[model samples]
Target: MTPPPYMGRTFPETTSHYLTTGTDVLDSAGVEAALKAVTSKGYGPVAGAQLVLLCNEREADLISTWRRGLPSREATADEVAADANAVGPTAKYDFVLSASAPAYLTDETIVGRQAPSDFNGLPVFDSYGEAFVIKSELIPAGYVIAAATGGPNSEGNPIAIRQHPNAAYQGFREIPGAEQYPLINSYCQRSFGVGARHRGAAAVLQVTEDATYTAPTFAV
Candidate 1:
């Protein structure tokens, strides 16, 4: 019988090299305007009723960005009313504010009602619009995100996770070892990808006045 091909192969032999690359699509003019509007003015005291204005601005900008992808048309009376009084299930956008933002919106004038012990969001409203401001510790200071929510067939969802079609390749899978002894060896592998879905469905505000934007650093 012929000897195995790798009978005397070196342990550290080089196999094949693989390279991966990715790219990001640039923001549209409308999205760029939305980002600029929020960041143009630096952070200041958003205490008391000012929180309502802030949430309105964020939500309006997000809506403007989403509308850029569609044809221009006059908003219906119902749509205008919905935008002006959005609350609870009618809210079209979610304001994910920085963790520290809750402190500024705690005033009785802004809160308007006694919140339930389990409630974690503060609903803010202006004459033009409204949204629920949710605080997230993961969000860096001076940053907020207004993301569209609740649409037919995941229409407004901004993020997506894709995986291999085969169930065995979707998540972690155990690789059988060459050895047949009782003490078996193995390895695990998985394949998946994650990325932004609806580009205009979300807007990120840096909350600064600097000409250029700076990404925040997180401490592990």
Candidate 2:
């Protein structure tokens, strides 16, 4: 049975090595930009009113370094080495932002439909009917309820079918590893994805290896 090769390193042990490390190519700022780009695609009329960006530490560091300006060109080789080392392992940074917006909520807001109730009959307890309901009057004529169904590798879950851009999330699986017999034979792999859920709700700047310092275009 080979005794399971002495369990050189458990899955958790190997995966924890990169707890403080980050992707070499992408940075946090780039992540925010990517998200902005996705949302920039005009998901709907009232988009970007509420926005959020998520990223790993490496990505955040990349954005921070770019904000502070890269090391000077006139610095010594040692300085350059130190600066880059500080930057750590960066890969070919690349990302595209996408935006999606669901059909405009007729009234663009939710309203309470029920006052109060006491269904259980507890003297100290008071309950209410469905607290909120879509306003039939507010729904525009010819409005059709939008619902999503199937998706790749999904089970019995509601399909994401809002009338906005669907961020087909991509990139990075397990990090590739180097072979070493039975012990330490593989390394952890990580990647990132970016997207938005509303039209005109997000602003993104396209960033790639060719241009990291350029400003993000405001146009979706």
Q: Clash totals for all models, in order?
A: 0, 33
Question: Where in model 1 is the C-alpha error above 4 Å?
Answer: 1-130, 150-155, 179-183, 218-220
* Candidate 2 global TM-score: 0.20
Cα-based TM-score, every candidate:
0.39, 0.20
lDDT of 1 by residue, 92-141 (tens): 22223332334454322332332222222443321212333444455655
Cα-lDDT of candidate 1: 0.38
Q: What's model 1's lDDT at 210? A: 51
For candidate 1, the per-residue lDDT at 43 reads 14
In order, candidate lDDTs are 0.38, 0.27
Q: Where is the poorest 10-residue window by lDDT in model 1?
A: 16-25
